[model samples]
Target: MTETPQEQTAADGSVAMQAGRDVIVTNTTGLTLMEARQVAIDVFNANFIRLADEAASIASARADALREKFFDRLSRENPEGLQQAKDPGFQHAFYTAQKEQARTGDADLGDMLVDLLVDRTKHSERDIRQIVLDESLNTAPKLTNGQTAALSLIFLLRYTRNNSLLSHNALGEYFDKYVKPLASKLATSTASFQHLEFTGCGAVGAFQFLPEQSLENNYRGLFLKGFDPQEINDRDISIGLDRRVFMPCLNDAAKLQVSALNEESLESHLASLSIPGEDVTKIKGLFNATKMNHEEIRAKCVELRPYMETVFDAWSSSNMKNFTLTSVGIAIGHANIKRIIGEEFADLSIWIN
Candidate 1:
């Protein structure tokens, strides 16, 4: 015959134990074994729920922070444009930016989203601006940080110009502060251009394939007004000026030369101002035209060798000649640059249509 169970109660009446074919235990809380097991499950679930709540709270805080930042920038930069936030399109984009910021925890991307939103208010083309904002928000998150960096570097090199005269020392400081950081984040492979093309940021093609004759014709029509045939021929011979050399072989060195000439022109414009002795010495030391020559340009190139190597690596990796940024590309590139550096360096007006 099976033995009958024996039960014992603790002095405090908080626990009970039973001895039988199967022993059962109770807790100090007066819970039976089965009740205690259910309590334990509840506790476990509560802990997980708390953790999930914490994560959600963090995401909410991030989203709120981004929203605050967007409003701050908007109020400061375009106070009257605050009415833009009332538009359905702008509201939709702002909501999307907030959601993405919460989801991705990327504050920089949030800034770019808001930047696009602010830019939208500046344009009168409502439908076009809406499309651009929607498409840009959709594509911006898809880009890796490295790819975004590549776009900014290209934009800086190809599209932008300094608004004010800067001494060589100032230029060097800007390069180190702004350009170098972007270069450091460039993708290792030229295939990045293909990715940019795939994302509708740009097109990768040979520069030679562009409408060269038309461009040359337009150039001659606009700027070749009073030049003599002999002078034109001499200029052409000096630079090997043709469609082939015009675009395809255009490199950083030529671009730098053009920049140097612009700086010289600016300096000449300001030559009448009488600066103090130390200021004059500093300016001359930094921008003396007589000292600016092939060797100086070569030295600048050497200073930029590492960054240029990354650029060459991208080209060699894909064997691509040129990448042209579409409007979408410009928007994203400008935003990324603004995030990496600041508005002072990443001027959107330069690329505005």
Candidate 2:
């Protein structure tokens, strides 16, 4: 039997179907040049419209979800403050957040905007808190999540301290739980710090002089704060001498307390500085003499070393040591940290005075 035109075209490597009087060609191999062009154009237009509609739908859903989150938080936390939504300042911030949320579709960014808008309802436009909130709403959207994370990490290292006894294990756990997730989102290049400076979130070179200060402060907060007196008491008991006699051990320990080293490595380094080939045992004795528990120190170091390495690598890779947050940066970074690590861990009280 002879094949029809459609069957002939199909056999010739062209897909064809009859739609009433029109021949709809999926493959234009058997069609004219103009027909092929028309098909290409139609396909492109159809796909383009489909993708555009999908994008719009996603953006609209995100905006709606953001509004829902905002009202939910406002109603629960500051029901009275909802009245301020009618005020110019609150409306401005709300709209800004909404516009940015639509453009970015970032839930974190939306949450931050919610925080700023909520905060605005609590303060007059003239208040510094409101002023900062206003500025933050403008600036926060310009930042990528990676840039915000970098800013927040720097802020935590510099401006905040642990309120309770600092433990290496706890520090490790904190970073693992709170920081590790964001760390993966960090940009591979140092441009994140540059972007932060350009956005007025921070100054790139401002912290150069105080490069080691954050690390030192962190080290002291983690290992030295309440442990010093305990070490002194332990030394006195072990050596059967006055606590004053073991003060030098505390002093030596302080000198040897390099922020970059874990306890075992630090002790080994300390021993190396002394008589040649000295074992870590002598270093352990030194810590023991100070009444510091060597075993506990080693255990803490075991837990903390990996976390320290991870943080230090991030800092070095991002050139974070050279970056210092401006007041705007501090506010945004504080908010970012609270978002990531929760409010209980995001203490900024030292900046209050």
Candidate 3:
């Protein structure tokens, strides 16, 4: 299941709620009921804009408390009284459904938000969120202030639904179908220049450079195992000499070899990428945020802290090879990644076996 968006403080002290499952955001401070409603409406409208045209019908058909609140008491109590409502069929169906649902004593609008936010994306998380964004935006012109805030809260619900589906659906499938097998192949390979196929991660064309930080598993013997001390040393030397050594030399003759090495090693190991077709020239631009100067690195890390942490957590939870290889290794990798960034990267070892 997807998680919910959390309320967080924006620079302006306005509560900003991201419309997704990973975090829920809201701030009830500084605003009248009407202004909150307007923000909420704007949010939902923006969400709807992210969807396809077909989702408009679904949005129109949805039973929202926002709309119901606009209705007089007679509309809520008399089925025929709502006949003149914009969507009589839908309203009637909603009334019927709610009537039955009320039997469970959970007919509140909060409970119905799930249905209101259905993504109808044929089960894809991207499609779901896109649908919500699209449809919510489509309904923007018709809402009032209070209705807007209420709708924003409702859109927040949609964001959660879509995020959960995306993580568990798209990402889950990606790891199962590609990351696992490729990481396994690389792990077991004897070649000095190991290659991982990136068919599933959506990368295109020839060999590409991946940052070491991008790697879900520790690049050190990530796939291969059971090597003696001599073998480990040999592998390290081979990695340095065969791959890391020449990365930056291709770009600038005078560039320090160490700088290139850091960029190349970090990109290759962390990003799970490599030079495409002997074009080591691309290594010049490789970015391993951690290997940069402390000031630059810290700034980048702080800006990207949330996303990086999330990625690390998800990656660690999925990568299994390293964790299975040795408890000591897992512990070390976990502590290392967390110290460098945060716990997000620790669980990537879980999915690598």
Assess every candidate by TM-score. Answer: 0.57, 0.60, 0.19
Writing each residue's lDDT as its tens digit, candidate 3 over 1-353 gives 88665665667644454553122223323444343334434444433333356555445334234433323232333333322222222223233332322222332332232223221111223343334322332232222222222222211211111111212134334333323322322222212111111111111233322222332122211211121223224323333333343323222334322222233344554345443422343333222211333233223323433343332233233322121212222222222222223113313223222
**Candidate 1 lDDT, tens digit per residue, 1-353?**
88676665567644333332222222323333333333322322222223277787876676667766766676677765555443445545555666677678876777787787667656535655457657888888878888887777666656665544234345456567666787667764666667788899888776622112221222111111122223324333333222221221112222211112233442453354443445433333332322333333434434544464454445345423366788788878887777766664444555654
Order of the predicted models by lDDT, top scorer first: 2, 1, 3
Over 4 Å off, model 3: 1-85, 88-93, 107-231, 234-237, 241-353
Give me the displacement of residue 112 in model 1, in angstroms: 2.1
Q: How many backbone clashes does candidate 2 have?
A: 2
Off by over 4 Å in 2: 1-57, 206-212, 218-305, 342-353
Task: Estimate, for each residue in 1-353, the C-alpha lDDT of model 2 and write its tens digit.
Answer: 87555432445544333432322233313444333333423332232223377787775566567667777776776676655543445555666676678778888988777766666667754766777778888999999888888777777767765534244466667667666766667653667777887888877774452314543434432433223444434444333323322232222454332222234445544454552233334434444333334334334444565554555566665567677678778878777766765443433333521
lDDT, residue 151, model 3: 22
| lDDT accuracy of residue 325 in candidate 2 | 77
Give me candidate 3's TM-score against the actual structure.
0.19
Which 10-residue window of candidate 3 scores lowest in summed lDDT?
Answer: 192-201
Instruction: Please report, in order, the local distance difference test score of every candidate based on alpha carbons.
Output: 0.53, 0.56, 0.29
